[model samples]
Target: MSSSRSRRVEYDRFIPFRSAMDMDYARFALTRPSRPQRDGSRESPSSVAYQKLLDDCILKNRSRILAFKTAPEAPASKLPQFDEPIRPQKKQQRRIPKEPERVLVIRGLLDDNVLNLLDWGSNNVLAIGLEDAVYLWDAANESTKLLQPAEDRGPITCIRWSPDCAVLAVAYGNSDLALIDPATGHVVDGMEDENQAPVLSLAWRSNSILTVGRFDGTVVDYDFRKDDMFICFYNGHRRGVCSLKWSGLSGRYLASGGHDKLVHIWDACMPVSRHRPRQRQWLHRISSHTSIVKAVDWCPTRSNLLASGGGCNDHCVKFWNTINGACLNSIDAGSEVCALLWDKNKSELLTSHGSPNNQLTLWNYPSMTRVAEVSGHSSRVLSLAGSPLGGVVASAAADETVRLGLLQHRYTSDPKIELEKWCQMGYNADTF
Candidate 1:
C-alpha cells in the first residue's frame, strides 16, 4: 500500500508563477484525438499533422493579453500627466496666540474653599464657592448674584450649573446638595449623600441628571425631574472624591478622581431604576497615580480620551484611553495639578498648579508640549473653568481672586473678548 501511494503522487512540470502557461498547455494536450488503430497498432502522428494541430491551438489561444506591451515614450509612451495637488491646511498653533488678556478679575474673597468648585455655565454665568457662601457672577451684565446663598447654610463646597442654565446645584459641607433656580435664588429641589459624607464634587450629565462625588468616595447620580431623584451610585475609591466630569460621545460617561489615588469611570447608560436603584459598578478603575488623583478632564474632541493629574506627592499629568483604560502618555508637571480644563474647539489643555509653581500651564494635546504658562495667582490655583464659547478660561485661586483670561488662541471675532474689555473696566466698581 505504501509503494502504491508513493507512485500515486504526480510531479509538477509547470514553471513557478507562470500558471497561465501551464493552463494553455493542458488545454492543447487534452484536446488531441485518441485514435484506436487497427490491429492494435499504436503509431505517432505525422510531423505535418502535428504542426497543423499546433498552429490551430496557437490561433485559438491568441488574445490581446498575449500581444506585446511596451512604453512608447521611455523609448516608448509620453510621460503621465497629473493635476495640481491641493496643499494641506496649516496646523493649529500649539501655544495660545497671545498671552491671556486679563478680562474680569474679581478680587478680595476670603480664602479657604473647596478646590474643585468653579464652573462656567452655558448661560454665560460663572459659579464659584468661597468658604461658606456660593456666588454667581453673571458675565453678561457684569452684575453679581442678586440671589446669593444664605450665610448660615454651612460652607459651600461645590457649585455646578446645569447645561440649560435652568438651575444651579450647590453642595454644602454637611453633605446636602440643593438645586436652586438661578434667576429666582430659590431652592427648588435637593438631595443628600446616603452616608452623610461631605459632597466634594458635582457633574451634570444633562439638565436633569446630576452626578455627585463625596468625601467618603461615594458617587451617586440623580435626575432632578423625577420624584425619587436617586438614579444610581458608583463605588471604588477609598477616600474622598476630588473632581468629577461627565463626557463621552453620548455624554453618559462619568469620570471621577478621588483622594484614594484612583480614578473611576462610570457609565449611566447601563440603566438604573429610580425607586429601587442600587450600587452600579465602575466601568474602569484607574490606579496609575501614587498620590491622590485630583485634576481630571475629557478631551473635547476624542470621546475615549481622558486626562488626569496627581497631587503634590506625584505631580504627574497622565493621559488615558478610557475605552480600554490604557495610559497613553504622561507628563511630569513640576507642580501639583489642582485642576484641568480643555479647549472646546481645539486640542489644547490648560492645567492649574499648586505649591511652588502656582502657575497655569497650557498644553498641546497628543504632542504634550507646554504651550504657555502664566503666573496669575499668588498662591496655588484652586480650580479652573473654561467658557462655553471655547476661548476664555476662568481660574480661581487661594489668592481670593478669579481671573478670566481671553486665551485668544484663534478667535478674531469672539464676542467674549468684547465683553471682557467691558468687564475689565467695570470689575473694580462691584465686589462679591
Candidate 2:
C-alpha cells in the first residue's frame, strides 16, 4: 500500500509504474477503450425499462458502490423562467451485442491437462495452444499460423505473452518451460523441472521472471537472466495448482487456486526458499470454495480487488477485497465458472461457464447484475481473452471452436468479424 492516495495516478497511467509485469498484465487483460474516459464519469440508461430497473437497484442497494464521483459543484443562480427549461442530456452507454460476431472451428481444445485459457498479445494476436503446438491467430485479419510445433515435448499446458509483448512463455505437458520470440520463433530460454509432473498453470511475473505452478504442488520462480535461473520457491497447496494469476497492480500479490479447493495469496516480498523455509507464508489462505478453483483473476483497475470462480460442485463466484482478506461479494453462478475476465473499460465483468449453459455471461460490477449472455460454444467454455482495442472478446471451448464476441462495437471499426478456423493439432496428435 502506498503512503498517500495522491501518489496513485488514474488507472492506465502506468507509464511510471514500478513493475513491468503489472503494466504488462494490465494492458493485456483490460479493454482498451479508444474514447477517453473522464474521472468520475456517470452511467446513463438508454431505455426506460432498463432505467426503472437500475433505479430500483440503486434504491435497494443504497450502500453498494455504483459509481465514483467528485463533490458537487456549487449551484448556479436559479435559471430565469423560460418557455421550457433546457437540461443537459446524459450520454448513454452503447449496448454490447448479445451474439458472437465471428466463430472459428478448430479442434484439440481438450489438450492433455492444459489450462483452458488463451492470451491476447499487444499486437492483436491471439495465442492458442493445440495438442502439442502453439498457434498465433491475428484478430485483425483472422489469419493464423503455427508458431511452435513441439511434437516431442508433449501437449502444451499453458502459454503466456510477456509484459513487453516480446516473448511467449510456453509450458508443456512434460513439465518443460521455454521462452521464445514470437517474431523469429527462436527459443530464448528453456528449463526442465526435476519432477516429471507437468505445469498446471503459469504466469509471467515480468519480462525475465516467470512463475510456474506444477502438478506436483510446487511453485517456483525463475529468472532467466540469472546464471542459476531458479531464484525463488513458494511453498503451499497440497494439490496441483490449476490456476495462477500474479496481481497486475504492484506485482506484490500472487494468487493461485488449485485442485485442493483452496485459493492462496502470496506476497512476492516474502521470498521463502528451502534454506529459509517458513510455514504458512501466504498472506491469505482462502477456503471459500468447496470444489476446485480453476478461474481466478485480479481486478484490472482495483489493486485490492480479486475475483475467483469455483468448480461444478461449488458453482460460486466470489469477489475478495484483499485489504483484510474479507469477502466483499459472492454470487452463485448457475453453472461451473470456467474462467473470469474483467471489462476494465467499464464497471463490468465477464465469465465463461461449463455443464448446463456453456455460455459467456457479462455482468455489471458492484451491482453484480447480469447484463448479457453469449452462447456459441457447444461444450464447456474453457478460455476467455479480450482484444487489445477493447471491442471484442475471444473465447475457446471444449467444442474445439473459438468464438469472438463483439463487446463494445463502437471501439472497433465495425461489429462484423470473420474467422476461418484452421489448426494442425489434430494431425499432430502423434506428437504426444
Candidate 3:
C-alpha cells in the first residue's frame, strides 16, 4: 500500500498542469503528504494547513487571475446622457452700410450738354461753369461767387481749375482760352489766335504748359506762360475732342476722348522728335467705344492702368494697360457712362451715369463689382470729382444740380471697416 501511494504521487507530479489554479493545487499536494481516507475520519492538521495556504494565495492574487479572463460585454444605451445640453454654433452674417451721406446740394447750376461742368479744386473749392458764367463755390464755407472774365468773349464753354488752385483756365464759345486768377476772377492771360475752334477741353501738363482740345478735333500743347504759344499739335480724332486728361502719376502720357467715338493715348514728347522720328504723338488708338468716349481717368494707384467709359450707344467701362495697349477689363455699366473718378485713398472706381439710369455707382476696381448706387438726379449725371480730403465726392447732372456725398470708405486707416465693406459688396472676406 505504501508503494502504491508513492507511485500515485509521482504520477500526479509528472502530469502537466493546464492553468495557474491547477499548478497551485499540485504544489500544495506535493509539499505535504496525503491524508488517510477512513470512514468519518477528520482531515489531518497538515492537509488542513495546506488547504488554508492555497486559499490565501488565491485570495491575494484574485485580480491577477481575473485579468487573464475574457471581459464581459457592455449593454448598449439608446440615448446618451450629458451634464449640459449641446448647442450648435451660429454662422456670422455680413453687414453692408447704407447709401453715403448727402452733405449738400446746389440746384440750377448745370444745364447743358457739357461733359466736365464740375471740378473740385485743390484748395477745397468747387468750380462750376454755367451758361455765360463761371461760379467758384468754396466748399469750406459753402459760399458762391461769380468769376468775372477780363473781357466778355462768349458763353463759357469749359472751365478747369489749375492744380495749385490759384489760377483757373476758362474757355469761351468764341474760341478763346483765358487763365484767370480765382481770387479776383480776372484774366491773367489769354489766347485766341492759336486755336480757331472753340476749346472744349483743357488740361494742365505743368504749371506753365496746358493741353487744349478743340471743337475742330485738334489737340494742341501750349505754353500759357510764353504768350499762350503752341508747342506741338496732335491730330487723330475725326470729330471734336471732348475730354482731355494728363496723367498726374507720370505726366508722360495723355488720354483724350473725342465725339468720334475714339480714345487716344498720346506720349508727352513732340510728334516728330529727332530721336524717335517714327514714333508719333498718338501712342495707342483705342477704338473700343461704339459711341462718344468722354469719361477718361488714370488709375491713381496703378501708373500703367487707364479707365475710359463710353456714351449712350455703348454703356461700357473699359480698363486698359497703357504699357502694352491691352484691354484688361470691360464692364457693361447698364447706362450711359458720363464720368469716371478714382478714389484717392482706395482701390475703387466711381462712375456717373446718364439718361435711363441717371445714377452714381461706386465699384470695386479690377473686379468691377457694383458696391453702391446713388440716384436723385432727374436728368443725366454729367461729371464727378473727389474731394481733396478723400472722404467726399461731388457729382453734377444735367438736371441743374450738384450733389455731395460721402465715399464708401470714410477712413483708409480702418481695416476692419474696409473688410466689412468689401464683404457687404458680395466679396469673400479672404479676398483682401
User: lDDT tens digits, residues 94-135, model 2?
Assistant: 776665666666667663223744889888898988776777
TM-score of each: 0.72, 0.73, 0.70
**lDDT value, candidate 3, whole model:** 0.75
* Sequence-dependent TM-score of model 1: 0.72
lDDT string, candidate 3, 389-430, tens digits:
676787877766676666644355784664454334331111
lDDT of each: 0.75, 0.76, 0.75
Q: What is the lDDT of residue 360 in candidate 2?
A: 92
Say which candidate scores most in lDDT: 2
How do the residues 240-283 of candidate 1 rate in per-residue lDDT, one tens digit apiece?
88788888467978898988899888876676556646878778
Clashes of each: 6, 0, 0
What global local distance difference test value does model 1 have?
Answer: 0.75
Please list the residue runs of candidate 1 whose C-alpha ends up more than 4 Å from where it truly belongs after superposition: 1-100, 103-114, 192-195, 270-277, 412-430
Question: Which candidate achieves the best TM-score against the true structure?
Answer: 2
Which residue pairs in candidate 3 collide? none
